[model samples]
Target: MIAPAPGISLGIDIGGTFTDLVLHDPALRRSGSLKILTTHADPVQGILEGTRRLLGEASVEPGEITRVVHATTLFTNALIERKGALTALITTAGFRDILKIGRERRYELFDLMLRPPAPLMPDALRLEVPERVKADGTVVTPLDLAALDAAADQAVAAGAEAIAILFLHSDLHPAHEEQAARRIAARHPGLSVTASHAIVREMREYERGCTASANAYVAPMAGRYLARLGAELAAMGIAGPLLLTLSNGGMTHVEEAIRAPVQLLESGPAAGALAAAYLAGAQEPRILAFDMGGTTAKLSVVEHGEPEVVFGFEAARQARFIEGSGLPIRISTVDLMEIGAGGGSIARRDAIGLLKVGPDSAGSEPGPACYGRGGLEATVTDANLLLGYLDPSRFAGGRLPLDRRAAQAAMARLAAALGITAEAAAWGIHDVVTEAMASAARTHLAERGRDASGFTLVCTGGGGPVHGYHLARKLGIRRVIVPPEAGVASALGLLTAPPRVDRVATLGRRLLAWRAAELEAAFAALEAEARGVLARGGWAEDAPAPERVVDARCVGQGAHMPVTLPPAPWPTDDAALHAMITEAFTAAYQERFRRPPPAVPIDLVHARIVLRGAARPLALPPARRGWEGPATAHQRQILSGGCSAMADIYSRPGLMPGFSARGPALVEESGSTLVIGGKGRFSVLENGNILVELDA
Candidate 1:
């Protein structure tokens, strides 16, 4: 085993609102975390500033850092803002309009003017190639190399830094696409190319093409950003291997990430779900991971210690919560239901005076009105501050002080417009936003056959802990687990993720095939391909074999579910293979529909495998070693509908295992502050996780 170099490792997660950084020293078992307002104009500035501030606080030299793991929403933001490099698209002849002709479905049927997402590549940049492939992995016509070369020249002349090639049925037969790419690369020399078959070999033409196009859209941006971030870190004397978190809730080397940033689009939310799944620690646990940031709130369900894995996701939607109104990307992402309810969400009265929370946010540049950052909009944070939920003086650990006057002015305008008091207006906004989140959580859970009561709430992100208690109350959840470093939870999760690579290919085979031996050979080939990728990513030759997987469905079903198979020498016998496939399909179906499907002829749609390296076990901070800190004096606060009562403020670091602090208390850590309202109880678990149980 290669020992991690002797130095502090920094994990940075750049979110829409804040850039979180965590510095840990394995040898000393010490760590520190920081949260800085994101500098959107130049994100690298925030990274460098945060890194310098954190290292200064720890009195550690940058040269002592051995590794850096990072995750960011930059690529997603670029796609959303259409700020990526000018790119071109090449497709099979007569398919130039494929992107424009999305699977035409309106998410909102009643809307008069619904707009499907515009393609990343413009019509002028979309060129067609002369090639054709049958659905069953057969090339009907050779790729027109001369035509491809001509298109390449056009794309280059048009200033396309990146190019996406997506041909029909390429997932079944990638040889044509591969040959076209090699020839184009040899000619263009500098253009970045992404082939649908190489990135995602799924059967859907639109989805596969969309995924590869999105990857190309963000390739140049991600490459430059990562290169700059790495150089900045090294200049500061840090000598560490830098890794990036992927949407699949795993880490990959930085070099791999720059080439395929589409995989990291959901990286932030995935990390939060990982943290929840790992720390929830309940038997067959059902968890609602609520991560609220400045721009949006993410809700993901976790069951049996793993977050649900989704094969495809949409981004940059015209409607934040609408599914089909965005760019579809084929990548494995932790299934999350995200909405525009966040601290920076601007609150307003709609046409009929009905309170509306948001689909718009006051990002870090000119944050909420309370931030006194030139934002005149009344936001959720302004409302929270007006309602006395946040300490205006202590916001962001006092790095950015809040302006009560600004908050009051913003709220007063809304109050006057609604004919209500400022406090009442603030209360209304807060409750409405909470209801929005709770309702979203409930809908996501019910759709998945999950109950809120069956799960523990693990809330993180900048706004998570602040809003968690109220959300729990609304959901009738009694237990809420707020980790010590709650605000930076996503970045912390990066430190624990194992290096993994997920690969997929379409087989389109029938389960009642002519030979079971053939199925075994197919599985073996897929597994070998996965191991090869893991090896290329620096895994040792003797590393454990990868997890084998397949996407299966009934013969006539239009879609399928992914199922994992036991390591190699896969069930080769006919009856055994059938049983294995049945068990997997049944379990997955049961989880979704609450019952097994009736026995029917099933088919295999796709074969997949994920090679995961042995995860380095994390050293959890010791549970507050037997709890005696300074004597705590009780302070008073108003109860639900009653008179004021006393509560204590305890220092979490001073608390030990078996020690407990009860309600109306404040637990302050360097990274974040946790407020335990009246009638709440807090405990330090053996793993150093703080469990807060609130009165329902």
Candidate 2:
């Protein structure tokens, strides 16, 4: 092991199928990377393995890692699998029915079978305490200590390993909830407790309660896993700070992550989006970033050089598309839409005589049927293989030789079910799955008032390049860029992220005639809280300045839009601050609703502050001056333009930047393959990005 060194950053991203690690040494101008299969039973194994490989490749000691930035899907999986510790929710007496009441709207209008997601806490476990606070931060009912003690006793006896305290409107005043949590923790010495006010102080009782419950739900798991990981790294002589990525596109200390694991639920995907945003360079704004991993595909809309920011997202839902059908959580997150369309996405026909691709996947264990590792179901990989979109012998840089016969046999089942030839069925599955992804992208963009045609698609991840061109065709996107080492893009993306934290408070006050001094104090408090977290994450004293924003809206609006705020005194003049708030609302309103609402009293719903440390740029490998060689004539028949054509096959790595491959050619990469159709021309970018352009 080498000694601890400065200017070295380590990033680890644990996805459903793979755990990717990247080690970057800024001073040396070099980076090392590894992508290993995630051990579902124990994700740490994958991390350790990947870390060891990266360190070995870089010839550096574990101590050389000055920072370890981690992102994992463990919390999201725990919620989806119901594998977290037994948890109980403690809420204000009158708000006991908040979870049951929900927002009172069906996700589907016509389906009578719609079932809202079951609450995380059961009625028996949701012990209520006698306390209340008005929406305006005014105390309504004094907390009943005797009743609260009784509730705590009941929760402890119920075998709860953790407790969540969420008093009604606690965002305005956390005194009651904080006191309740302290009392409960004191009584139950070893039990983990989560207070809604501490985790996320915002409006909406259901979202607040749900977020706290989720934090408590994953606390035990995160704490134990992180502790073990830290020990493992220590054993290897790495003494640097371990930072975990957050859904807000920032990194937090491991201690904060252990306390609020829900914040890391969508962290992995957020990193990929950040990478796309960074790679888009000068065209950052109005770009669509597509990340297709082995288990899932995530889409994020980048507007004005920044990804859209979302305050709330759900997880562990039975149905993917149905809103209000999953565990709700309130956290600052990079706005993203996910679908189960990736390398291992299973493809088959449903009972209604219709073809279906997935929301279910084969994952990495058995992987695609073509991998020939005991998987029986046909998947996207099998479909691609059957259609000559993949080279069976050259798969994964020859590390994994795909069994074409296995892919064919699997597709044969689908062919029999659909009453079509195996070849035709395979092609249909490929086309339909591509259509499904394109449709999802279109719907996601449409809802946000975005047009897919105007944006350049940046594809990454293991399965991204395989489907990038087809997805582009379906979306009518003329240009697509597939960067070098596309499969490891997410891991590389992790290195470009900053160490930061987002803190918010629910004030719910009107600006007109409101006390500006009090508001300034509240903003200061939030900023202080954010800075504290940043400092704990080991942010350098001379790092870039922190950022602050507020979630505001007109009094009558149902939703709040984020508004940026200046640091410090926060505009001394009441009129000036009001004008700034109004300006922010008008700009955000036009972006979302396309029009600002008529004059109405403006309200400051939530004050948010973000602190971040400066991040170093990623190092790019210089491009090769020439191609691997000319493509050899291959007699494989492929369906294109409603006809069959013989295509030529070529190696991917052999192709150099500025190299152009015409349509009717098969370009094969290690983890994926690209099928260039007629009228399509593919060129490599300066940073070794593969650009595929199709003529209309």
Candidate 3:
């Protein structure tokens, strides 16, 4: 085995259907990638196999891999499948129902049968201790140790595997929660303790409690999986640091990831967004990143070479698109909107006798009908296959042969139900999913006050390039960029990601009564905590200066907006600091709302710092091995404008830079396929990205 080299890195991303592996050797400015069906029962088995095969094919030594970056849907699946460990929550007296009583608001106001998501921890498992803290951080009723002991004992006796502590006002004063965590750990050595303050350190009992309990629920399981994977990789003669990507588009050491698995809930999608940003950051600074995998479509906005980050997001959503219809988790995550529109999204007829395509998927176990996995339901992939958008012989690099007859049978069943031809039903399924994705993109960009029409679209994932053309057209987006190795882009993104950590503290204070000394101390503490977390990865010293932002709002406002501090040194003078913050707030508010702040005092809610270690530079191959013959490999009929047309098929690598083609044309690669409409004009860029321009 060769010695470890700084230029060699490997990345693995496990999605709903596929496990993608990318081995990058920057010294050679080349990357080798592979995709295999995900092994849900033991995801590490697939990862190990994929990693070994990739290295073997490239004739590379396992010991040469300097680092391994990975992202998985394991913990996220656990939450959604309700397969996590038996968890229990302990809160302040009279607050045992906080998780159930989430703001007392219905996500669906008009629906009488609106059912919120069930709590991860049931009522029977939630127990409160004798403790009370005033909203102002003053202890009212001291914590009763005997009461805490009784609750812990009762919970353990009832078969609780993990415990969560969420005391009232713990965001402001974590003493009680910390003490309870210590006691619980000492008494129950086998149980994992997740304290709310340690998880969120912010206000809102329901959200913080949900985050803590969810973390505790998945911590033990995540720890064991990480340990097993790490041990197996080491046994494979691979000497490298193992890291996992977070929902915030940051990569952290396996230890940190195991400690807080909830932060990884949406990690798989985050990698795709990061990859899109890096691939198109220079060509198009602002873009709508569209990643369509097997089971879901993830969309995010990237501006100025960075994907936006949200302080909180919902998980295991009951209603896939509706906000607040899922477990509220307050952790930093890439700002993304996910819709149940993907290759394997099952297509069916709704109660209204109208056609609907997914929020339900066939997934890997019994993927699409075309996979010949005993799936009889019509799915997006089946539709695409029937529409000739995919080459059955070369799908998944011919590793998994597609059965056209199976897809036809599935589409025929749906077509018969809708009283339409199998071909018509296939087109309908395609358009329905596209419309769903476009509608979601419109809403997501509008919520951020962004214009989808003004942004280019960067397509990634297995299904992204196939639907991106129509999705862009629907949104009035003129330009779309398809990067190299588009199907495994998320796994590739893991290689480009840097070590990052976000630390937040709830500092509910009035900006009017600013105390520079106290605020500085708080900032110091938050930054230190963030640094310490990064230190475990041996990357703190090389990281760039951390970014500072505060969540603030008018005293009477219902929601707080995050305000980025202007580039300046830490202020010492109270008046100067106040002025600086006030100006920054007004400017940001004006930009967002087109108006100045209301005539009310501004309240600072949370202080946050994001520490980003420098990413190892990734080199895109200057060119690829293209077909020696004509670019047009063959001609296939594709549905264009709800009509059939013979589209010229081209292999992706066959098209060189400055090569231009007019559609209808299909660009096929081993990883993904791009469908260009008749009105589209496309070209290959110098870096091997296919740039598409569509006329409205």
Q: Taking the tens digit of each residue's C-alpha lDDT, what string does model 3 give over 1-696?
A: 122247688999998899999988888888899999998888999999999889998999998988888898889889988999999998888878888978887888999989888889878999989999888878889999999999999999999999999998899999998899999899989788999998889988888989998999999899899999999999999889788899999888887888888999989999999999898877787989999999889999999989999899988988877888999999999999998888889999889888999988999989999999899999999999989999999998888889999999999999989989998899999999999999999899989888998999999999999999999989999999999889999998988788889989998889977688888788889888988887777875767778889999999887999999964367799988898888889998999899898878899999998889888778767866566568766799989669999999898876778888999999998899999999999999888888999988
**TM-score per candidate, chains pooled:** 0.93, 0.94, 0.98
* Tens digits of lDDT, candidate 1, 1-696: 232444577889888888889887877788788888999999999999999999999898987887788888888889888998888999999999888898888889999988889999889999998999888757777888889999989999999999999999888788888898888888888788988888998888888988999999999889889888888888888877678888988878776788788999989778888777765645337678988888888899887877888778898888876779998888988899888888889988899988888868898879999888899989988976665546566667668788989999998998888888887778788778888999999988877767888778888877887778778888889888877677787777788777778888887877777266877676667677666655656665535777778888877788788877767766657888777777877887787667787677878888887777776555655555644467375343422212234546565677776677676766655445566777678887767677888765
Cα lDDT for residue 3, candidate 2: 17
Extract clashing residue pairs from model 3. none
Which parts of model 2 have CA positions greater than 4 angstroms off?
Answer: 1-6, 136-140, 540-545, 566-570, 626-643
Kindly provide the TM-score of model 3 when superposed on the true structure, using C-alpha atoms.
0.98
> Which candidate do you rate higher for TM-score, 1 or 3?
3
Clashes of each: 4, 2, 0
Per-candidate Cα RMSD to the true structure, in Å, reads 2.7, 2.6, 1.8
Q: Model 3 misses residue 160 by how many Å?
A: 1.4
Candidate 2 lDDT over 553-632, as tens digits, reads: 88887977787766665678888878877887788777778776678888888888777777657655566575577667
Model 1 alpha-carbon miss at residue 657, Å: 4.3
The Cα local distance difference test for each model comes to: 0.80, 0.79, 0.89
Candidate 2, overall lDDT?
0.79
* Candidate 3 ranges with C-alpha deviation above 4 Å: 1-5
